[model samples]
Target: MADSRSGRSDSDALIRVETLAKRYETAAGTTPPALNGVDLAIQPGEFVAVMGPSGSGKSTFMNILGCLDTPTSGAYYLDGRNVAELSDDELATLRNRLIGFVFQGFNLLKRISVADNVALPLVYAGEGKSERRRRALELLDQVGLAAHADKQPNQLSGGQQQRVAIARALSNHPRLILADEPTGNLDTHTSEEIMDIFTRLNRDQGITVVLVTHEADIAHHAKRLVRFRDGNVVYDGGVKGI
Candidate 1:
């Protein structure tokens, strides 16, 4: 996709942030900025893992990237459009069109069927019921969970529920996937299974994946790793050797 404002092609960075920072206000006082002057760029189809301990600011950065939170300073460019300049509705539309999010929790509704859960995003995007069902089943099939389409969330294992979440994230055919500790709730083998699906999506389908995980083993699955410390990015490089 080309950016009308900058006239940049798809070869340009899909996500770019310059000196990005965010701070939250507490009842006592203003807390320290969660992110402080971080600069980074992610190209299309790149799989990057973000790692940091509690209070390290990785989650804050991911929230900003996902358009779930606003930065207090600096600029974030998604597909060459400045996030700081977009209105709330524009941000919502951009998020729905260009980004998919997967969280550690399955976040499935117990009242809904697995296929309906996968189709949730489509519902928000104003898709017809039949079309939503079609897309949901196709995505479920991709994640190896088509057989469970008629089941409820409680009927599936943690891993299966997470697969349903992944299918939901793909419903809009988003260019970027922001996954926050996607395997945190799963066991070792189940974590591996989820990572395998992510790897296949990034490699075969050319989807850009930015995942935040505290586990070193989970970070290794990504081609590149970004480590945060004390509200700053201390490391950004290949996954090997920490």
Candidate 2:
């Protein structure tokens, strides 16, 4: 029964979008707007799920939230700073410092050891080699993958690989996690295990989680659900009775 409207004060919101819209250009001409007049506010330490059918604009909205794409018009603010106002370098730094990304593909580097792969983000942040290795091992331990740290990606099962991916995502100690179909490729049991990990992270660490999923059961893991249809949010409320 909580108010689901995006009318919360901007000063307290961790993420906010106002009148957001996006359009894609095709060879024929501009396509209809992928997103239209969307308004949302996500606070820190909350878990939210987004659901929609194909081409319903859920993916577009996630991309914009992740800073991988921009809205053609309107405003997006992250951590109290307007996204459009930051320079490219500043944006990159902000993203690195504030967000962690998890994807369906696992996205681990097959060429490296699991620990090294987890350490990749620290490398970009310019941590020393020994320090990176130490931190990577620590994260691997947190994910219950410490025993597999020296092994290559191919040596692990799909679920284990995804655990490594989750560990890697946490390497930078980001405050927010943006997960896009994180359990899509896993089997039902494996998917549940992955979701459990995410749930623990949110509950124990107070990290804000925003996830996109097509499955009702998966969306049920979140405390709040936001459903999109035809570039609009048709539902935004508690997950129960959805």
Candidate 3:
């Protein structure tokens, strides 16, 4: 099926998949399928949400999209690079350079200062200490956490901690942002705030965002929505209000 878009340019596909399938085989030779022959295309600067009920394979899709796992079959082209062709180490390096991840739990180092937490990705990227600190401060400021950069995770509110997590995700200046229930831990108001931040980043920074969420209200914030059922995409379309 052809992926539809609203006046998108021809030369801007950030991710593409064809007949993507995933399955797991245990030691006992019991095989359970996860994804079944899915095809999708995501363009640059697009904000897309993958929504489904539990056990619907959307989680498996997210894992593959994030490069945290590989598909058992089919092809996945991420930023023009074939996922199946890359070595494990190459995939790790590609993930470090191209993907920024935000999880539901706000995965930050609990004992570190917010600044240090935000700098962790840069550290992995081999950024110098001074440069890491400088960039981390800039990202914290962007997320409105500069004033509290010295605080530990326990010192910040839920929303603030999630913001720090976001800054850490962005430290690599990745082309794609993969957020898996990023607002799951926040209150309604905090969730709205975080969603606003994501929307702004997608719009202003031209970052492609793939969000996995169960909430329709949360999914509405995305430009597009793709629903999964029975290990396959059931619907891929634009959100009603744009």
Q: Best candidate, TM-score-wise?
A: 2
lDDT of 1 at 229: 96
The lDDT per prediction is 0.90, 0.91, 0.89
- Model 2 Cα RMSD, 1 decimal: 1.4
Judged by whole-model lDDT over C-alpha atoms, candidate 3 comes out at: 0.89
Per-residue alpha-carbon lDDT of candidate 1 for residues 134-202, written as tens digits (9 for 90 to 100): 999999999999899999999999999999999988989999999999999999999999999999999
Off by over 4 Å in 2: 4-8
lDDT of 3 by residue, 1-242 (tens): 23565466533579988899998898988566789999888998889988988888988898999899999999999988888898988888877889999999998889889999999888879999999999999999999989998888889998999999999989999989999999988888999999999999999999999999988889999988999998989988877752
lDDT of 2 by residue, 1-242 (tens): 55653556767889999999999989999988889899889998889999999899998998889888888999999999999998888777766778888988999999999999999989889899999999999999998999999999999998899999889889999999999999998999999999999999999999999999999999999999999999999998999987
Query: Higher TM-score: candidate 1 or 2?
Result: 2
Lowest lDDT 10-residue stretch of candidate 3: 1-10
Q: For model 3, what is the alpha-carbon lDDT of residue 111?
A: 81
Off by over 4 Å in 3: 1-11, 27-31
**Cα shift from native, residue 141, model 3 (Å):** 0.6
| Candidate 1 minimal-lDDT segment of 10 residues | 1-10
User: Candidate 1: misplaced stretches above 4 Å?
Assistant: 1-11
Candidate with the larger lDDT of 1 and 3: 1
